[model samples]
Target chain A: MRHGKYRFLLGALTLPLALYGLLVLWPYLQAFYLAFTDWTGVTSEVNLIGIDNFTRMWSDPLFLAALRHNGLMLLAVPLAVIVVALGLAAGTRGTRVYRVVYFFPQLLSVAIIAVLWQFVYTPNSGLLNGLLTGLGLDSWRHSWLAEPDLALWCVIAVLIWSAIGFYVVLFAAAMESVPADIMEAAAIDGAGELTVFRRITLPLIWDSVQVAWIYLGILALDGFALVQIMTVGPGGPDNSTEVMGLTLYRTAFTYSKFGYASAMGVAIFFLSLTLAVLMLKFTRREKVELA
Target chain B: MKTIRHTVLTLWALVFTVPLLWAFMSSVKTDAEIFDSPWQPPATPHFENWSRAWEQASIGRYLGNTVIVVGGSLTLTMLLGALVAYCLARYEFPGNRTIYYTLVAGMLFPVFLALVPLFFVVKQLGMLNTYHGLILVYTAYALPFTVFFLHGFFRALPGAVAEAAFIDGASHAGVFWRVMLPMARPGMVSIGIFNFLGLWNQYLLPKALNTDPDDYVITQGLAALATSRGASSDWSGLFAGLVIAILPVLIAYVFFQRQIRAGLTAGAVR
Candidate 1:
C-alpha cells in the first residue's frame, strides 16, 4: 500500500492509461475545441467561430429534424424491443425450439440486417408489396423507405425488428436471474403471472432495465450505418431519417465540414452522456427494494 | 392451454426469424430466381455465390484486416485492462478510486461523441487506415468495461495470497503478471470473448476511418458490396458476404456463449 511498493503497479497501469488519454480523452478534448472552429474537412485552416456552431445547430431545421428522428427512433425501437422482447421472453421460457428460432436473428450483422430490409422495402418489387398484391390489398402497400413522411418510421421499424431479439435474450437472462423464492411468495399471495411480473419480476430486474435503456440511448445516437445503407446518404427520401450520427457523417464526409461534424459529434456525446447519467441517477441502487 | 402457449411461442419465433431465413434462402438462389420467386428457396443451390462473393467482393482481404484489428485490439485491451484492474484491486495509490471511476465512465460514453475527433487523432498519428490505429482506439474504448469486469474478478481473488507474494518481495508487476493473471484465467477468457466479439462486430469506426478497399474491415467491405452498382441487387452475393461476416461471431457464441453472456451482463447485473 506504500508509495514505494506501489511503483510497479503504477508502471503496469501506465500504458493503458496513456492510450486511453491519447485516443479517448485527448480526442474528446479536441472535439470540444473543434466545435468552436470553422474548419471544413478539406482545408487546413480552422478559424475560431466561438459558439456559432452551437447557435446555428439550435435554429437549424435539419438538426432539429435529426433530433426529432432520434426521438422517434428512441421511442419506437426501445418500446418495441421491450414489449415484444418481454412477450417473447415469457413465452419462450421453457421452449428450446422457440428460443433458438427467436435468437437466430441476433447472429446477423447490422449491415446484413440493413441490406436484407432494404430489399424487403424495395418499393414495388419488395416482398411486402408482392404479398400485398397477392392479398388484394395492393393499394395498402406504399413506398416504405422512399416516402419522406414515412421513411423514418419505416427505418425505425426495421431497427426494432433487428434489435428485439438481442434485448429479448438479455431480458430473459435478467428475468431468469430473479430469485425463485420471491416469485413463489407472490404466487402464494394469489398473484397471477402478470401480477407477479409487475410486483416482483420488474422490480427485481430494474437495474437491467436501466442498463438496457442506457444502451438503447447510445445505440440511437450511434446508429448511422442503417440510415446510410437504407436511406442511401440523404438519410431518407428527404433526409427524414437523419439522426445525429448520420448528420455527423454527412457533415464530415459529404459536406466536408470537419469542424461542424466534430461539433455535432460533441453534441451527441454530451446528449447521450447526460441521458445515461440521468437514467442511472433515477434508477439508483436505493430504488430497488431487493426484498 | 399448453398447446395454445406452444403455438403462440412457435409463431412468434417463426415471425422473428423470417429475415434470417429469407437471407439464407436468398443466398443460394440465382439472381433471376431471387427476383422471380423472392420468398421461395432456390431450385438449384448456388454454392458459387460464396466463391464469387469471396473473390469479387475482396472479402478475403477484408477478413484478414478484421482479424488483425480484432485480435490486436483484444490483446492490447486485455493486457491493459488486466493491468489496470490489478492496480485497482491490489494497490492503494493516490486517486485510485478516481482512476477506477473514470475507467468506468469511459464505457458509458457513447461512441458518437468520440468519432469526429477520433478520426482526426488517428489521422494525425498517421494511423488513419492502419490496423494499429484502430487497435489502439478499440483498446481505449474497450478498456472501461474490460477494467470494470476484471476489477470484480481480481477483487474476487483471495487477497491473502497476494499479500503472501508481497511478503516474499515479489515485485508488483511480477505478482500481477506471474501470479494474479494466471489465477484469473476464467476472468480473462470471459473478457477476451466479450472484447473479441465486440471488436469483430464493430461497423461504424472501421467504415469512418478506412475508406479504401485494401484497408477495409469485414463490416465496411460487406457494406460496400451491398451498395455497389452491380453488387446492390446481387442478393446471393450479399447473403454470402453476410454469412462470412457473421461466421466468427456465431462460432464464438456457440463455443463461448456462457462466458460472453456472463461478461455482457457483468456490468448490468452488478
Candidate 2:
C-alpha cells in the first residue's frame, strides 16, 4: 500500500513539477548567470565580465532616477492606500452597497485603468481639468502627465485610486472579525469612534495591515505596465516616470543589452526581497488573541 | 456621525464609478462632441463606434484570443494545481514539505526578474508566439497561488469520504477523482474565478512572448490600438475599445462578486 501510494504521488507530481522547474525555476536561476555576461541576446557567443554590469548600474543616471521614483512611490502609495482604506473600512462597516462600488476598480486590468486615466489627464479636454476649470480653480490645471515634476506623482495617484478599494475590502473583512462586544463596550465607556478604532480595531487587524503593506510595496516596485501604457515614450518626458521594470524592458528589448538588463532584474529581485523581509520584521508583533 | 460616514462612503463610491461611467458614455459619442463637451450626454448616440472598434480596430480578434488563452490556461492550472495540492494536503512523503515550500516560494519571484531569460527559454523551446506557450507560462505562474489556496481547502475536507471510497475497492486514482475532487468544488470555484480574471487580464507575459499582431491578447491589442490611434482622430473608437475590454470583467464581477472578494482576500487575510 505504501509503495503504491508513493508511486501515485510521484505520478501526480511529475508533470506540474517538471513544468514549474523548466519554466519558472530555470529562468530564475539563469538570471544570476546572465547578469555577469555581456550577451547581447542575439548571439550564441558569450563573455562574462564579473560585476562590471553591477558597477555600471551604480553610476547610471537613468537607473538611479528610476530607483528614486520607485522609492517615492514605495513611501507614498502604500501609506495613502492604508490610511484611506482604513477610514473607508471603518466608516462603512455594515453597508454592502458601498463595498461593491469601492472594489470595482480592483476588477479592471492595469491596461484598461491606464487608458482610462490618459483621457482623464489629457491637457485640454480632460475630465480632471474640465472639472477644475468648471469649479473656478483654473490655476490648478496643467498637463499632468507632460510635466517632469508632476508625472510620477500623477502615476502614484492612479496607483492609489486603483489599489485602495482592495485594501478597503481586506480591512473591512478583518474589522468584521473583531468582536462587536468589545467595540460596544469601548463606546459605552466614553471612548469615541476614533479612539475605539485606534485602541481596539487597529490592533486586532494588524496582521492584515502588515500583509497589505507588503503587497502594496511589491506593487509599487512594479509600476511597469501602468508607466508603459500611460506615459509618453513609455517612461518619459525625459524618463521622469521611468521604473526599473520599464527600464529593463527597453534596455533588453530595444537596446539589445540583455546582460545589462539582467543586472537590473537582479537588483530589483534583491530590492523587493529585502523590502518584503524588512516589512515583515518591522511589523512583527505578538498576535492579538481575543478572549 | 452616521451622516458623515454615509456622505464619505457615497463620495468614494462616486469617485470609483464615475470614470467607468464617463468612459462608457464617451464611447457612444462622436469625436467632436467628446472633445467639445466632454461631460455632457451625447446628442446622438453613435452605436457604430462599437462596430468600428469590433471590426476595423480588431478588438474582436483580440477578445477572442484573450478568451481562448484564459480559458485554456485556467483549465490546466486548476487541474494540475488541484492534483499537486491534493497530494501535498493528503499524502505524506519524504519530500512533501520541500516540494510544497518550493512551490510557495515561487510566489515571491517577480516575473520581471525572469523576463529576459524567460524570453530566451520560451524561444528555445519554440513556444514563443504560440497560444500554448502563453498558456503554459500563465499556468506555471499561477501554480503557486492555486496550490496554496487549494491545499488549505483540501486539508479542511473530511477524510472519511475518501477512506470509504477506498474501502469500497476503488483505486487511489478513482477515490481522488470521484470522491475527493467533488468535495473540493467550492475551493475550485473560488480559485477558478480568480485565475480566470487574472489570466484574462495578463499583459506583460504575452507582450514579451507573443509579439505577432494576430496573436495579441486583449490587453496587448488594446495597448496597440491606443498607441497607434491615440493621437489620431479615432477617439470614439479608442473609447469603444476600452469599453469592450472592460465590459466582460465588469460583468464577471457583478455575477461572482462574493467568490471574487473571498478568493482575493483569502491570500492576504488568512
* lDDT per residue (tens digit) for residues B89-108 in model 1: 87776889998998787765
Candidate 2 lDDT, B91-203, residue by residue in tens: 98799999999999999888988999999999999999999999999999999999999999999999888878877888778878999999999889888878887888798
User: Candidate 1's residue-wise lDDT over A164-246, tens digit each?
Assistant: 76777778887887888988988999999999888777777776777777777667665687888777555867778888788
Stretches of candidate 1 off by over 4 Å are A1-7, A41-44, A124-127, A130-139, A277-291, B167-169, B230-233
- For model 1, name the residue pairs that clash: none
Q: Write the per-residue lDDT of candidate 2 for residues A225-266, one digit (tens) a residue.
A: 899999988899899999999999999999989999999999
Docking quality category of candidate 1 according to DockQ thresholds: medium
Error of 2 at A160 (Å): 0.4
True contacts kept of each: 0.60, 0.69
Q: Name the regions of candidate 2 deviating beyond 4 angstroms.
A: A1-3
